[model samples]
Target: MSDTTPRIETERLVLRVPRIEDFERYAELLADEEACRFIGGHMPRPAAWRRFLQMPGAWAVQGFAMFSVIEKSSGLWLGQLGPWQPDGWPGTEVGWALHRDAWGKGYAYEGAAAAIDWAFAHLGWTEVIHCIDADNAASQALARRLGSRVLRQSGMPAPYEHVVVDVWGQSREDWQVRRSTRA
Candidate 1:
């Protein structure tokens, strides 16, 4: 993790901004057909390279973006999750995509919880959404686990205009209530 980048540590994961060292694994994750299925489909190296750059660009330009989720024990790149608000987005979002190897380990939920807190506390976001594909029941379950319900159905922009997604979210007030209850 870069000292300059913002980071959040959970019990078993480290969420931090995308660094140059992360590209290989990021590209690998993007290339896995099963893993990338719901996340705009698996791409070749060239396309993966372009897609991989988006996170760092978002961090550098927008001052916030998905963090590279690292396993605390293995120090491995497990996934990405955090604040994301691109042009034509459905809403302020805390999105996630994990390497298949990391699935079922609860990393996405763990990282996203921290990301949501960071977005609400540091970014001053009023609400946060997850643009989940209809067929992705795993993500749907994760969204529910995060205390977000389906706020609406929405279409994407430009290259993804043909794809529609469920906007799952909760307000800052709702999240605070959930957090307090969990405590």
Candidate 2:
């Protein structure tokens, strides 16, 4: 609830503010073509450096940003997933982007659910969105699993303005109901 990034822990993962030490692994994810495809195409190391700093910068400026996901068991860097809302954003969003190696293990779902709960509870967010690429079926499926439906279609901000994405989301009331049902 504080303006600082908080460490969030789930059954199998830890979400905390990113650190400079995470740069290498984080850059690896940014540089992986397949992993970065839906988010943005892979970039060179310098670009990756800027991309890597973006999250921390967001945290500093906005007091909220993506968390560096760590596998609790192995202490591995999975990827980033949490609240994000840059200039001209469609809405407050809880997004996810895991490394290719971290896929297929339900990490995205688990981490995103936690982040959504935090956003609704601590951030006073009435609703949350996921800006998923139209062709990213995997992300679309995850959005469905998270109880979000396609609210509309919108374009991203500059540098990604050419890409049209589906805005999938649910209100806090609906999210709470879904959580209670899951419990």
Question: Where does candidate 1 stray beyond 4 Å?
Answer: none
Clash counts for all predictions: 0, 0
**Clashing pairs for predicted structure model 2, backbone only:** none
TM-score of 1: 0.97
lDDT of 2 by residue, 11-47 (tens): 9999999988888888899889999889889988899
Candidate 2 Cα errors over 4 Å, as ranges: 1-4
State the lDDT at 147 in candidate 2.
Answer: 99
Alpha carbon lDDT at 149, candidate 1: 98
Error of 1 at 162 (Å): 0.6
Per-residue lDDT tens digits for candidate 1, residues 47-119, read: 9888888998888888999999999998999989999999999999999999989999889999999999999
Could you tell me which 10 consecutive residues in candidate 1 have the lowest summed lDDT? 1-10
Prediction RMSDs, each to the true structure: 1.2, 1.8
lDDT of all predictions: 0.93, 0.93
